[model samples]
Structures are given as structure tokens and as C-alpha cells.
Target: MKLVEVLHMNGGIGDISYANNSLVQRKAILMTKPIIEQAIRDLYCSLLPKNLCIADLGCSSGANTFLVVSELTKTIEKERKKHGFQSPEFHYLFNDLPSNDFNTIFQSLGEFEHDLRKQFGEGFGPCFFSGVSGSFYTRLFSSKSLHFVHSSYSVHWLSQVPNLIEKNKGNIYMSSTSPPSVIKAYYKQYEKDFSIFLKYRSEELMKGGKMVLTFLGRESEDPSSKEGCYIWELLGIALNELVIEGLIEEEKVDSFNIPNYTASPAEVKYLVDKEGSFTINKLETTRVHWNYASNTNNENIYNNGGYNLSRAIRAVAEPLLVSQFDPKLMDLVFQKYEEIVSDCMSKEKTEFINVTVSMTRNN
Candidate 1:
């Protein structure tokens, strides 16, 4: 498949499948709330703005945006009371890609409008909320207009496919055998993306402002290990099946690759420090289990809201599997995934799939 085709397929699959799921939403909320609350407190205590302006970059649809806004409002109120100061007016900017589902976010906000007015009273404090659609890497706000910025589970995404992947003549991302050339190209792309991200964020953020972000990361530098991402391996197996069925050419399937960039905490710190605009205040990496058994008692099978390892495997494989494989074959693929997970569970544990990093823009 063409690179663009692969990107479209993967992006669509992620949005419809993983991004919209309730299990991921619940886990994201729990993991992010505390960090957001603390960041708000720090922003308020440090800046003490009578009118606070905050921006949430990559604030996708559904409960995620509301969860962040709710926590922020509570933090602002709490800090105001603790400092014996009047509540400040809040101006919030919720941003995401232009293609994101803004309707859902807007609908949720509309439902809470009455409640918000009741709590703060009509014009008790100026509350302005606007939705901005654009790439976060470029200018999204007026100069020095923001006091706090928050982004979660979004930065790892590259603005575009890495240039190296585009340039590679041979199998860039996919090969039956580990190819050093492909790995080098992937890292070069990641480096370029990371640098661009740092520069963009530095330009947008005001002095002493703060940003909190979380993304998928790797624990080891080793590229061959499953520690980087088991999901990729699972998808590879499904893709091989598609090749056998001749839905996609074997060469194309072999050339297909997942563009994942994982930076260690130390590496991240170096990048930020070199940018000369941010200081790493706190960085912590934690493991979040995306797959869990619906019933803790069911040892033989795993299910969570009808999404288990089998379901997840299928979701990732659907791009290559749909036209190629029949329903029965698809079922067999899921069964195979179940066996893989079962064997994995028997031998070891699954944890630490995501990384959370928090930083402050230097004055």
C-alpha cells in the first residue's frame, strides 16, 4: 500500500476504534486528572493572574475535554479560596485537528453551560471558550496570551509521515528481517519531528508557562524487543495473512511499517533543555493496561467491554484483513490472538505501555 494509504487506514482505525473507546477514556482521565490539577495550582500560585487564560492542545471530542476543563475550574476555585483572592475570569481555548469531532465536544459544553453559569453567576467572571482547529506545532494563539497549556496523549503523533520513510526506495518500515537501514530512517524521522515540536511549543508558550503531556514510549533502546510495542507484532501477523490471501502484494506488505518514536525520559530532558525555553520539572513513566479481562475470574479468556487482546488485534489488523479474509478466517485470527495473549499471560505480565512527561517553560 502507498504510505498515504497506510496513514489514512491507521488514522481511521485509531480514531474509530481506540480513540473512542470508554476503557481508554476512563484510564486517561484517571491518569491525567492529578497531573492537571497540580499544574493548574502551580500556574495559579506562580502567575496569580486575575484573569487566567489556558489552552488545551489536541483536546479531542467526548469526555476528555470536559474532564480537563472540570479539573481546571475546580483547581482555580480552590486556589482562589486558599489565597483569599477572588475567583478569576477564565478564558479557555480547546484545540484539535480540523478533522476531529468538534460537535461532541460542543454538545457536552452546551449541557454544562447552565451549571457553569449557576456556579459562577452571570458575568460574575468572564468565561470565554473558543475552539481552534489547527496543528499545535504552528502558531495557534496570540503572542504571550496564554498562562497555561495542557496536552495529553497527542504529541507522539507526527505532523506528517517522516521524510525518511517517504524517501526509502526499498521496504522502509516493513521487512521480514530486521533491517538496519529501515531502523536508521525511522530514527532520523523521529529526531526531525521532535525538534520541530520543541521549536513550535517554545514559540507559542509564554515565559514561566507550563505544559503537561503523555504519550506511548519505550523502556529500552533495543529495537527488536517487544517492549517497544506488542501491538505492532500482532499487526504484523495479521498483515502476513493478508499477503497470503493476495489482497495486497507480498512486497507491499513487507514494506509496510508502523512509525512509532519512543524517547526515554533522559533523552526527552535533553531535547527540552537544548531548546533553551523549557525546564523539565517532573517526568514520570507509568504503565497503563489497555487490555484487561472483563471478569477477573475468567482466566481462560480476556474481555473488557467486548474489547480484549483478540478484539484489539483485530482492530489493528482490519486494514489488511477486511477484503482479504472471510469472516471465518477473521474469527480464526482473533482466536490466534487469544492464544498469544493467553500464553503471554501465563509466562509474564503486561504493563507500562504509556509515558507521561511534565515540563515548565522557562522565563
Candidate 2:
């Protein structure tokens, strides 16, 4: 499917991660960065020469790309120093959907160009950087070329619409009362997407290459629970408001469903085991706390991460706020959402809001 169509169809309406300025997101990155570096080091140590070709899939625009590269480079440098060997050359490729904001990523890289050059030095090694735009589940690189692959906040996304949902005649995934058929349809799509992801990665990564990935996931095996996902609830509220305002027909809203799915850690393990390409080096889920507003004093929403809540909702909300709702009405809607969610936040009193998993590729 086309990028916009895929996003609209699947409910990937928000940014894949929280807003960049979120302190909670920054903290999560800081906590995760070291682990990622350690994984790269372990993988690099297993390989001779230490020259690594790394790819970050679904690396959307902004500082995230630089964050991964910075961690990888520094780790390699430290390892080189410890071994008393010359630093290996680095080939860093960033991949995302064609519709993503590449200009933003390019601009961020430009800002860091001088610093990167100074660190690597001209003619020091074959350091290559390129942006490859395409679906992660499709061909984007030569076979057996990548040494390490990293994707964060990606892969939970399906490459296409769910088949069962279509066959079910609109009974599933419509509202808070999604039927079993709807849930099955969602899983079916996830299965397909994940299978394609494994196959693609298996083809692109060389023997013994490693992959580290982090995405939104469920802790529970049960699919019907609403505990972990706030995006669906928020979307339901937004659609209800839109219907009440007569901006969109109730039938149209009912026909639409979020095109995203989350798997439990066990379910993810199952997929990997079944695929037989990647081995589970380490798989653990940790709560990631994210905050959108800078004013932490506001007790309405404490943590704002996972299920791509802040970014995904803003993607849909910002455009609708501009085109569909009047300025005053949009302001009121935002306020109402905050008011409704604030009490829940206080009641829950939980801060962390993410699920992270890491893995490796087997020869």
C-alpha cells in the first residue's frame, strides 16, 4: 500500500515514537543506548576485522538516526582502543518509508557532519552513509551485505491491511467492543508482516550478523485487554467527537480501524522460533515513560509513550485541527481530552510506558 493509505488504513496516524523533546523519551533512549552499544560490541567481537555495515530500518526523520550512529561509532572506537587495533570502517545506512521526512534527517546529519568528519578524520577509513527509502519488509539492499541491523519503534507495523478484518464484514476492530473476529484479523496481519520481516532480514544480513529491535508490544497473551494501549481509546474519543460535530459520518468512522498491532513477548518469541532465522539473544520488556508537555506539574498525563501515542495521535489531530475544526473548537477538544485523561493518570500513578525487546540473527 501507499504510505499515506497504509497510515490511514492501519491507524498509524501518529509519529512512530514520542515527540523528540520529551524528557521521558530522552531518558528511555539513554537507558537503552548502552544496552544497544553492548549488543553491537558483542556482535562486532564475534566478527573478525571489526569492520561493520549497520542499517537502521524505519529510521524516521530527526535525532534518532544520529543517536544510533553515535552509539555505534563510540562503541566501536572504545573496542578498538581496548584491542590496540585500528578502528574498522563503518557503513551506516538509514532506511524509512519514502513518504517520511527525509529532509529533516538530512538536515540533522548536516549539522553533525563536521563533528563526524573530525572524529573519523578524512581518509581514515571507508565510512559510508546513505539513506535508503522503502518498506522494511521489501528489498532495499543487496543480499548478505548487512552485518548488523537495528530497528526501533518499527516492525509492529503491517505492510498491508488485515485479511480477516476484511472478510469479517466490518464486525471486528471497530470500537471498544471489538469481536473475536476482529482480534483474529489483527493477529493474522501481524503474522504476515512479521514473517515478511524475517524473510527480508534473513536475505539481507550476512551469516552471523545480528539485529537489535525495539517496538511497542503487549505483556499479556490476551488480545482483548485495553490496559496497554491508549491510542485506540483516544482515537475512539476523537472519532466520537468528529461524528457529533457532523464533520464525518458515523458510518465512515465505524468503517475505519487502526492498522497497527502489538504482540506479547511470548508471541514475538514464537514468531522468531517459527521463522528459524533469528535467535533470541535477549528478550525483555521494560516500561518506557514518556511525557509530552514540558510542565510536569500538570497532573493530567504523567507518561506519554508506547503504541506511538503522542506522535501518532498528533499526526491525525494536527491536520484535522487545521482543516476540519475551527480554532476555538480544536482548543476545546484538546482541553477536554486532557481533562478526561488527567484523572486516569493520577489514579494509575504509573510513570513508565514502553515495551522493549532485543534479538540477534543466527547463521
Candidate 3:
């Protein structure tokens, strides 16, 4: 699959749109807010330039996108209030794949800017917004332009599917049924892509700039662990059900694969160390139930959790699924998806491991 051409969240404000279904990502950001705040707080502010350039990579359209910036501004304000110093002017850039809905974000800018002015008041210096469209794997800024950079739930997406895995059938991602070779292909991809990501950020970031990143992660070094990608396993199961019903061709399903990967914490550290550009300041992991709800009655839990979980997954996977399967079958696919999730949730715990890291660009 051509990831840059096809990979994007479902768009606009419909029931299945990313805007409505990104609670899990939103919660993940909030859960890790402290890491972001500390990264900003400990930036050795004595050396910052007069203009503070900030960038949010993979800043898919929605309220969460601006919330990331708002939090940064708040952290900056907090530092000024606590240390009795003034903050530099802010220049904010929101970036995502070219296929992302920049219109949705730009339309909200008036309100977004107003909110910032209301929160920070008249003293807030020249906070600017520019929508940048491209993959973060490539350098998106001039050298020494950025003081802080943040990306959430994005690095796990590989630039493209591993070629060797073209022979692997049935599974769209790493699974228990995958061969040792398939596992290695994914590992290799993550290692290379992550290395480039670090390298580019290192070049663009001014010396002593901070980067805070988060993505889906696994608990074990073994790539076959479902801890990071069980949701894809369930998605594969859903697609197979469509085949069994004769609604789609088995070969079509076999020809499809998700252009994504989940890295283990060890792999993340290894690439960062090998790249030798950034010093790791904080690397931490957290988990949230796939359903994203911990307390509820069994009936509400089973019904609401399964349905909502399927919707959330749909928002992320629908674009890829439609490219391979009949677009008309999306409704049926997620219907079966909900059933599969309901059955799976009742049988076992369904949670996802998320890794968040903080680093400083070396001098």
C-alpha cells in the first residue's frame, strides 16, 4: 500500500469521523500532559531565542490538536509566573499528512486564536498558526527553527508496509500467526523510520530544544506480542468474517496490509542511542483499556464499550480498509467488528500500551 497516498483518519464531523472518535488519543495526551509540561519547564530557558518556534507533528485535525498547543502556552506561562521571567513570542505550526483536513483546522483558527488571547490575555506575544502538510519522516522546518516539538500516537505508522511481508497472508499486522521473518521485517522498518525521525528533528531543533513523543508500544521485545497490536488482530478477524460471508474475495483480503508498526521500549532507546543526536530525558509507558472505560455495569460496559470501541477503530482504519475492500461494505464490516469486539471484551482484558518519551537536542 502507498501509505502517503492512502493513510489518513476518516474526515469531517460525521459519526465515524476522526473528530468524533478520537477520545482514546485525546485521553492519551492528557494522561501524558505532565511529561509535556516538564519538558517545557526544564528546557534550560536561559538559552532560548527571542522567538520560540513550536511544532506539533501528526497534528491531525480536531480540538486535541489545539489542546496540545494550549497546554504548551500554559506551561510557558507557568514557567514565567514561577521564575519571574518573560517568555519569547510564540510561532506555532500544525502538521499532518497532506491528505489530512487542513480546512477543518484552519476554519477553527479564529476561535483557537481567540481562546489563546482569552487565556493568556493581551500580553501574549504574536502567537501564530501555520498549517504544514507533509510526513514528518522528512524534514519540515529550517535548521534551528524549532524550540519544542511534540507528536502523539503517530510514529508507530511506518512510511510503507514491509515488502518481505507481502507473502504473509490473513494478518494485516504483526500477529501470533505471523512468521519470524514477518516480525523481523516490521522491526527493521521501525528501526529505520525512527532513526530518520530522530535525525531530522535533531537537525531542525536548536541546541537544547526539547521533543516529547508518544505512540502505541508493546511490553516485550518480541514483535509477536499482542499487547501493542491486538486491535489489528481483531480487525483482521473482522475482515476475515467478511470473506467467510462471501461479501469480499479472500485474495483481496490477502492482498491487504496495514502500514503501521508498534515498537518496543528497547527498540526506541536503541535507535535513539544509535542516532547519537538526542539525549533521552524521560521514557515512560502507560496503558488504557481499548474500551477506554474502567468503571461501568456489565450491560453498559459490554454494549457501549464494544460499539464505541469499534467506532474509534473505524475512524483510524476505514481509509485503509476501503482501499482494499468494497467501500460500500464499510458499515457491514464495522457491524461485524462490533460483534467481534463484544465477544472479545467479555472473554479477556483489552488494553493498549502507549509509550511516551522526552528528549533534548544535544549541543
Return the top candidate by lDDT. Answer: 3
RMSD per prediction, one decimal? 4.7, 4.8, 1.9
How many clashes in candidate 1? 2
Off by over 4 Å in 2: 1-26, 117-126, 164-176, 290-312, 315-336, 350-353
- Where model 3 places Cα greater than 4 Å from the true spot, the runs are 293-302
Tell me the lDDT of model 2 at 157. Answer: 66
**Best of the two (1, 2) by TM-score:** 2
Residue pairs in clash, model 1: 287-352, 294-303
Task: Give the TM-scores of the predictions, in the order they appear.
Answer: 0.79, 0.82, 0.96
TM-score ranking, high to low: 3, 2, 1
Candidate 1, superposed: residue stretches over 4 Å from native: 1-22, 115-126, 165-177, 292-301, 304-306, 309-347
Best by TM-score: 3
On residues 131-164, what C-alpha lDDT tens digit does candidate 2 reach at each position? 9988887878899999888877667666754654
Model 1's lDDT to the true fold? 0.63
Q: Where is model 2 poorest over a 10-residue stretch in terms of lDDT? A: 8-17
lDDT accuracy of residue 248 in candidate 2: 51
TM-score of 2: 0.82
